[model samples]
Every structure is written in structure tokens, then in C-alpha cells.
Target: MWRIDFFLDNGYENVSMNDIVKHAGGSLATLYKHFGNKEQLFIYILEQKSEEVFGEWGRKSVCYEGRIEEFLTETGRMFLDLVTTPDAILFHRLLISIGYINDSRLNKTQIQNLMSVPVIIIANYLENEKVNGHIEVEDTYLVAEQFLNAVKGPFLFQTILGIQIDISEETRLKALKQVVTIFCRGLHVIQ
Candidate 1:
């Protein structure tokens, strides 16, 4: 956790394994043995954060109960809350930097795993709904991708670019509500 915090405070290249060992109170050999190297440590941190944000997302069962709009709106709100946090923003920026800088540290598989977790979760939920006649989705995976993009589109780029990092609660709720409304309308959840 300290290593992750250090990485977030300092950029990827700025932080070193020595710094991590110092702040985290661990031996270099232990870190090396566990993570294999600094880059691997960073990747592990990303994995932990991704799990923290998107893990057990569907644990609290969605109660459709004839109010699909409510479910969609709540899910959209959760997605926004998870992705728009300061830490999440920082994590994504680090990911982008690693990607563009040609850092082979973050392998393609790790990148896909980081992104695919939520997509898989949402797609599975949609698949179940389609099966039960709650909604008619021809391709649940594509719809899930579209839904995530729609929710994150308004804020991710601005925050990642540092154009506007902070989002007020009122604005956040309003935007999420609008996204949810449009998503429901598109899916014909409400007519």
C-alpha cells in the first residue's frame, strides 16, 4: 500500500525499489522475490487497485423488480464513483504513461486484465438480464462496453489531462442521472 501511495505521489520513473523498501519497511530481496522488480511491483499495485474499485461489483444483487431504470442509474452512479476518484485518476495516468512510453513493464495481458474486469462483470449481468427477459440485448458484451464508455466519457479525459480533476457532487449526480436516463431510453428499459 505504501508503495502504491509512493508511486501515486511520485511518477513511475521517479519512484524506485529502494524508495519503496525504505517507506514500506521491507528488505530489497523480499520485494524482488515477490514482485521480481519495480515494474512488476507497479503492475501489482494496479491490479490491487483495480480489484478494490471493481471487485464484487455485482455482489449486491440488482433488484430489477420492474424498475430497470433504477438499476441502470444506480450502476452508472457506482461506475462514476469508482472511476472518478483522485486515486483512480492517478492510477489511470500512470497506466497511460507506461503505455505511451513504451514501457514493456506493463504487458499487454496485464492491461487487458485491468480493463476487462468491469466489462466482464457488466456483460455477465446484462447476459443474465437478457436470458430472463428483463431486457433484449443482442450483444451484451458490446452493450456493456458502450455503457461504460457513456458513463466515463464526460470526465475521464479531462481528469487524466489535468484540465479538470475535481467533480462536485451535484454535477456528478446530475451527469450520472442524465447518462442513466439516456442509457435506459436506448435500451428501451423505459418507453
Candidate 2:
């Protein structure tokens, strides 16, 4: 928790093994012995936080009284709630900060791949839906990515960048309906 806390509170570039060890109550040798280096430690923390943040969504069931709109609405609402969270925003900003540091040894693509749990979840759902003739998409993965990016991009970006932190429930619901409707229409959903 301390390792994640340190990195999220202080930008990734500003934190050090010493700072972590100091705050986490561990010796530098032990930290090095366990994590090997700062990069590994950061990666470990990133993976841990990623799992913690996304695990619940991954566990979300696609079942919603057999309604695709209901499933999509739930997913979109969850995504909106997830990204607007303070912890999530800080985590996202940490990633953004890492992007500007060349010496971090972890590239943007690496982080993106690591953080692709939502895309995987969506793709699997879309693939299942397509098989059942509930939707039609040439490529489930690409369509899933497009849906996720389009659905969550604006409000997420606004809150994350401090442009607008408190999106009203009415606004979120409206956005969810619009995104889900557009996505379903694009996919040529049968229902």
C-alpha cells in the first residue's frame, strides 16, 4: 500500500527507493532483494493497483435480464464511476506523468498493454454477443476498444485533467445512454 501510495502521491519520476523504504518501513537491501530495482517496484505496484482497480469490473456479469442495453449501461456507468474516482484519477495521472519520463524504462505501449483488462473484458463480451447473433462486428477486439474509448473518453479526460471533476448523475446517465445507443447501432445489434 505504501509503495502505491508513494508513487501516486508523488509523481513517478519524483519517487525513489529511499523514499519508498523510508515510508514503507523496510530496509533498502530488502527492497532491492525483493523488487530488484525501482522500475520493478513501480511495475509491481502498477500491476497490483491495476488488478485492484479493475478486478471488480472484470468480475461483472454480462447478464442483465437478457438486455444488451442494460449490460452496456451498467458497463458504461461503472467505467464512468471508475475513472472519476480520486484514486483512479491519481493513478491515471501517475501514468500520464510516467509517459513524459524517457528514463522510466517502461514505455507507453507496455503500460497500455498492462492496463488493457477492460478491453479484454469488453472484447470477450462482444465476441459472445456476436456468436449469439445479438450483435455484429467485423472485429470484436477493435470494436470493443472503440466502444470503451468512445464511451469513457470525455468525462474521464475532463475529471482526470481537472477540467471538470464532478459530472452530474444526470449527465453521466445521459452520456451512458448516448454512448451505448451509438455503440449498439454501430455494431448493428439485433436487439
RMSD of each: 2.4, 2.1
lDDT by residue for model 1 over 1-191, one digit each (tens)?
A: 55477877887778888988888996999989999988788778778877776776666435554566776677778888878888889878876776777645657687777788787877777777777777776898998898889888889889989995447777878888887778667776623
TM for every model, in the order presented, reads 0.86, 0.88
Model 2's TM-score against the true structure: 0.88
> How well does candidate 2 score on lDDT at residue 18?
94
Question: Model 2, 111: alpha-carbon shift in Å?
Answer: 1.5
Clashes of 1: 0
Provide backbone clash counts, one per model. 0, 0
Clashing pairs in 2: none
Show the colliding residue pairs in model 1.
none
Would you give me the overall lDDT of model 1?
Answer: 0.76
Q: Candidate 2 lDDT, tens digit per residue, 31-103? A: 9999898887877777787788677766774565346777777888887787777888898888888887777
Off by over 4 Å in 2: 62-66
Q: Show where candidate 1 strays beyond 4 Å.
A: 1-3, 62-67
- Which stretch of 10 consecutive residues in model 2 shows the poorest summed lDDT? 58-67
